[model samples]
Target: MTYRTSLTALALTLAGLVAHPSPAVALSSVQWKSCPAYSDEVIRSLRVTEEQVPAFRTLMKRLECGTVSVPLNHRDPGGRKIDIAVTRLAATDGSRRLGAIAVLPGGPGNSGYLDPILRSALRNKEMAGLNERYDIIGFDPRGVGYSTKAACPLSPMGPQEPGTMTKETARKIYDSQVATNQKCGRSDPAFLGQLTTANVAKDLDLVRAALGERTLNLLGFSWGTYLGMVYRSEFPEHTGRAFLDSVAPPWTRLDRHTKDAAAAAERNFGRMATWLARRDELYGLGATARQVREEVARLVGAYDKSPKTFAGLQRPIDGSAVADLAKLNSTEWVRAGKALAELRTTTGTTAPPTVKELLGAPMMGTPVPGAPETLNMTMNLAVACNEDAGRTGFDTAWRAHQRLVTRHPATGRGWGLGVRCAGWPLPVQETTLRRGGGSLVLAGHLHEFMSVYDWTLQTRRAVGGTVYTIADDVHVSATRVPECAADVVRYFDTGRIGSGCAGVALPS
Candidate 1:
């Protein structure tokens, strides 16, 4: 049977099972225990240091940690089981407590288990209200964080090197990516095919059952929005109030979604240029936004011809690097402009201090010594590849890249969507998500590059909900905008969200 047909059959089977209650069978309750100990190396991989362990432990004192056993393949509940790591902060006011609220962080790979500590350290006060009446739950999805991890070899070509628009360069990158994925498959042959969003949603349902909650509230960001949608679709009867922040469109194809992301980045770049040009006296890049954009393009061309080397960075900063940096949101435009200006002033010997510091910092591809390969990146590949049923071969990927470069030259190459899952050794299981009859509050920022505002509208329409748009450049609305955060908190408390795009706070 086709993937969609199987999904339909599964949905019907699940509905029938639910309709005909089976009193004989019950899901096993979670065996709560003290959180498992992690080595210093593992702790560091989570970006928590040895010095912070005492505080983290102290924080954990007030919460509970455990693992939920879930089937490796949800299609067969009697199949091999895997452990999903979970953390819970019980509601302070149990008298008024609502059900559990599962926090799903973005990156398909990001650890939700660490979100509580990270939020505490960042002083995120917006969710303080919800914390009073809801048990805030976080978990590492299967094959991520403290969960059973899936390891893979790094690409042999090293971190994606800046590419020239040549067939040879594209071919080399594609082969390297494929080899890297193949290596991951070899490393964890049994689990790679199971690390999909649909399976993750199934694992989530198991978590809810173990918590003894019949329903759950969902708070999802970026890729998490997609997960939330899937959860609502499969288990709509078990869904409570949902707050989807920085929504991602329901696109099954990775290439198309990435192309849309590149276009959005280009639009965001335009906004940044306009903002910089208005402050021309301070930045001195250009008097008009158009001139500023043209100047940026010119600089990219000049740097492409001859890359600049800094004192601290191992690799030289090239045109591609500049273009990539330019795609940053409006908040970072000033820094980007400063870096550009410093590059323009290079006399082939002296490097500006700011430029040196910026270039010296570890970028996306920078490999840290002794650091474990992140579960986020690994699972991202697994999930994206598992869901994508469209063309992922070298030729198709090359054409996508070419189209991106031609249409959105400023940010296309930097998007890095090409050849991501070209050699993923997994069968596609496309999810046929149906809109659940649940009230949802979707939120987005006007300037979000990755999850653009259009995605919010599309998702809102798909799920039938009110959208709370923030007139700001922040990526995730709830974290940055107070009003947006208030809406989320209010929605959780009362099943309604106040509408208005008033408060626009710029990121610090």
Candidate 2:
């Protein structure tokens, strides 16, 4: 599985940013030390907070945190420096050790510094073998964590914004995002643009050197899966066994990705409708799936024309609020369905506390400057805006949103009404993948809304891999559930995926 990035071509295309020739000696070896205890404020404030911190602390005491010095610009190795923060959990049984595997965090910006310590805790049994047999390493990619932060105000993720996706609101959102893009880019586009996946892959290889390891095995979830593929393409020789959970279709277009996600959301909602219809006696949603769908749509449309205030909500429950709930995962369908049913027929001035609690932020305040979560918000947009090459034109985005919401009302409004990365100063950098690798195993969920099943096939078409399907409708469940994790453990242990691995941890 030699995947050398069409080196000849990438070398030229990348010019200075990637595909280096006669490259300077890669940086290796970090100065390791006991990790300092991160404050609970910092931990809890993180966008992807690991809540089991109190439990992970038992193993956290054994963790080592350090920094490996790399070039701010890979092409200019001797210029200013960047420190990639890392955490390592050495093998408990060195005599039986295989090798090291770097655990890449998912968010383009989420901190991975704590991943090795937290993910390998005794409670996270899926990673037990990795903890015992090899050095499990985690790192904060450049522009994240202690590495460096791209300081830019970020638009809130999910349905954090209020209001319906009318042409007026859509156009306004698009304009504002475009403005934000122009302003954020001017804060050192040349330097910030270097924070691409290709560069991160280079950082990973350097991290490999730091460990004195010849080959690195891998395990990545969600967006982490995408990063692993890029690493494989860049340095396949150094990549050993890789288990990519929730494979992101290498189709790198943000518009396409989000649009597809909306479709998945709609499909999952339909499944929920069927489930709710069967329990009509309890939910009183409807006797049939079609009627349930219609009732849900009618409720959402009413909110579109006239939003209403529940007893405890800081803001009114608008169409977007109801529409946003349309994309619940299979696990949340029951709770969300019950919430929706109450809203449709409620005679009280109060709404369901659970739903209101779930809609935690009706009036989002300004992001706290210097908060731990700030790093994520800034970097996610900076990295996405830096890479996405799509339509920034307001007219196109408006027309697309109108068409989509009309067709898939439950999911369409959530797709796009804003021009993402509009007027970003950085030139778009592109990547090409060639299919030949087979050391990779991809995990796919049959009806999961996020990273739908088709994307798994799409990714496999680009690079060869064995895939096992989860007979559930949840995202990234393979490595988390005992039955599904069997395949992953087997792949890492024997360099082969196990067959007939079954079941996921479905909630009662």
Candidate 3:
């Protein structure tokens, strides 16, 4: 799914999150079990269906495909079974195969099944070099994408009617959100317990065994960094090369996350405002950058009364949503700016489509980690409640938010003191995720409000790796920045971690 941008307030608010509990010591020896027994004619069964057989054949022509069944519980050799799905785009130069490279996507929930195809489109010389020698492997992790998945009905967290929830109303809504998460936990007792980094790392091991590889190379992003870290710690012998971009450290606190995101997003929004103003001729929102800021402020203020409606649906165009839209690279900004300006400038008598209606389809296959179409509140609450060890309450969140909003009004009101994930019911996982290894590269840009540099810094510390600070103002570096991209492709291809990589320097 397309990733969601971090709200500026989320960055600031989340910055305070303390390091998670010290993780359990890595497990030695995964009690290996034979693949789940299935009909030997499983392939034959697929082939028996005329249309399905041809589709499988077409898939095989492009890539080698396979399924490896794993124990639902790694601790129990004999337990309920789940199959992990894997696909590979083999090295084109058949004779010069280096080994297997696993693409670890972000979200702690996003799938990596399409990275091989996505990387193929890059056509960079360095990426081409890796393509020539390595079979890029993409797999959907347990509860994500095409893997053994989990679903919660939308009835619990459905969208509100426009003007139904003000900031005060949102707090009340969050009470039910907390209950919904607690209920989801009760609904799916088994899967919820098994979603930790350690379990996922072990899942990687099963995939490694199935692929018949002694060592596996990893490429991880966002939350995927922790997955790789855990994998490395548990099976150092199985580790090969690893490259992490937009790193999420194992020890970030909610408070620290909130602070960093808020500060960074405030700046990113300003940058976005400038970019928007530059094309004022098209968007016509403002004649200059300062004017653009005024225009954006006007939009936010206007939305407070009633969100702008695009089509028939309501739009929760909150601060984070706005910050997310700003983080798009320059190319996307122009089109987004035009749309945003028109939406903001239009009168209430005429409305644009709600964000939900405009983006009717699921957001998939893009750099943003969370699925924009999925219920945001659900995922935010689920993951945060699961990951947050913080013991603070909604009242605490509200008080803190008031302080921030009072200070930075324009961006603050949207994020300032919002009680989205503060009311989670489950106890946070108390594991500090540091994986010691050699030559891991942590990369992130300055202004990724969602996956901020703090995450990168924390991940670098945890993995005993170096940080590659991008000289750009956007987030999701590997896909956006050129120099950072080159360094990543080089590291993956040759396992070279550059030394003394510097942050963006001020001009002389």
Candidate 4:
């Protein structure tokens, strides 16, 4: 999900995690060993050429890979236990060493064991400099890959395209998901119930104890940002400076968060419309923001009534597809406008082009540098359902979905109906983040989608911290940016935030 890399190796202490092991399970220290095959995608993202692969491989060969045993429930450390997979890259210069920095990734299920690649993948020497001063740590949380996996049948239904989910369709989907929740959640209630964010934070403290370190700094993103906050809250005395990029809201009401995200998406759509309006002479969509929005809505409605066939595509060009594009990442704003313009022509009077000719090429991808990350949808459901306390039933859910769809046309139709937790097996452990740790640096983007920008400000307000506003929409991208990476390294080396620096750039 994130990345890191590096040099001299350290011997595994192989000693007891605590002065003595728990009666139920003996905790082992992280044992450094031979690393697994590096992710092809991660290597590709780093632009690690054939010539560079050999050296890169040699560099990563020094990577420490193993696991640490932690209790399944921190409340009962003497109860059943689970293994937490881990990876570490020792600092190149131990003499000037600061301490360890854990790379906490986004997906509650995102595998982090191979993330040490960002040190070499990123464009600046900042990571290299940061590496010299620290030991980078990566771990797959319990119930994720390499760690004890949380298994269950995935929900039969998922969020659908905008304009396609009618009240009837929503009800059917909700019932199916509720059924999945009961069945899957019942599979392993004891272990699955322990997979909350709070438990992960407890596991991090265990990792710190195993490392024999008094404090551990955090380098987290998206979901990881929330994880860092929780860790800091749980173990403030052990938590050091944290760099949380693309921060999540400190609050835990999943429904409210979902509503805010849908609103943010519509707001971003407006921003894209403004951009297209300025270039109306070229696209012929509209001369102003409001006109462009109306034209897009009309185009979507027409396609909804009757979709047009297109070769080489999996599905026809329909209202659902139209809405998705209209609110895609900013990088795709140009193509989205042209595609809608082409649809507008045909629906209104006569015509459009073979998709590519109208919409142009697909947008660039933002892949993580690790083995292809998978969403243990099983883990996703368990975590989401357990984390969300609102537990919205179908009645309230339908009403909320209708309100969102009617109020926010651009993204509301596609937003989740928010009823999955209604029949969840585990009791909700709503966590209210309590600030206690060292200095924290929060980074946010202006045109974000999944983890909206507002959450950043909300998080800062929740827990006092310095904030950095990124102009681009890419999630968790600060370390990938040259200036932002420097700022991040500076913060870790000496707690200081960046000025109004540039973020990921949009296409020219």
Per-prediction TM-score, please? 0.87, 0.89, 0.74, 0.86
Which residue pairs in model 4 clash with each other?
A: 3-118, 4-115, 4-116, 4-117, 4-118, 5-116, 346-351
Clashes of each: 1, 1, 45, 7
User: Any residue pairs clashing in model 1, and if so which?
Assistant: 109-376
**Each model's C-alpha lDDT?**
0.72, 0.72, 0.59, 0.74
Each candidate: RMSD to true structure? Answer: 5.7, 6.0, 9.5, 8.5
Global fold similarity of model 2 (TM-score) = 0.89
**Comparing 2 and 4 by lDDT, which wins?**
4
Residue-wise C-alpha lDDT for candidate 4, range 1-508, written one tens digit per residue: 0011111110111112112212333445876556777665566655666566666676677788888888876656776778888888888889999998998977777777666655422335676667778888888888887888766865445434434567888888788878777777666666777777887888888888888788999999888899999888878899999988888988777788878888888888898888889989877878999988887777767776777665544346666677777767776776777777666665432235535554333433445755444445666677777788688889899999889878876556555678867677556666767878999888888888778888888898888888888888777778877888888888899888764467877665
Question: Per-residue lDDT of 1-508 in model 2, one digit per residue for the tens?
Answer: 0123354643343355533432675556797766766565554554334766565556677788888888767777777677888888888889988888788777778777777765544435776766778788888888887786667644443333456666676666766776677566655554576877778778888888887888888888777888888888877888888888778888667777767877787887888888888889988889999988888888778777777777877756777777777777777776787778767776676867666766656444554445433236567776777668674587777776777788886655545564777776556776666553338888777778678878988888888887877777777777667766656666777887664244554444
Query: Which candidate, 1 or 2, would have the higher TM-score against the true structure?
Result: 2
Q: Backbone clash tally for model 1?
A: 1
List the candidate 3 regions with Cα displacement exceeding 4 Å: 1-60, 120-128, 154-158, 161-167, 252-259, 276-291, 305-313, 316-329, 339-345, 352-384, 413-427, 477-484, 497-508
lDDT of 1 by residue, 101-200 (tens): 8988788787788665544322246766667888888888998977887666655466544435578877877888887776664455457777778778
Error of 2 at 310 (Å): 2.3
Shift of residue 281 alpha carbon in model 4, Å: 3.2
Give the CA lDDT, 0 to 100, for residue 192 in model 2: 70
Query: Per-residue error at 141 for model 2, in Å?
Result: 1.0
Better-scoring candidate (lDDT), 1 or 3: 1
Q: Give residue 201's error in model 4 in angstroms.
A: 0.7
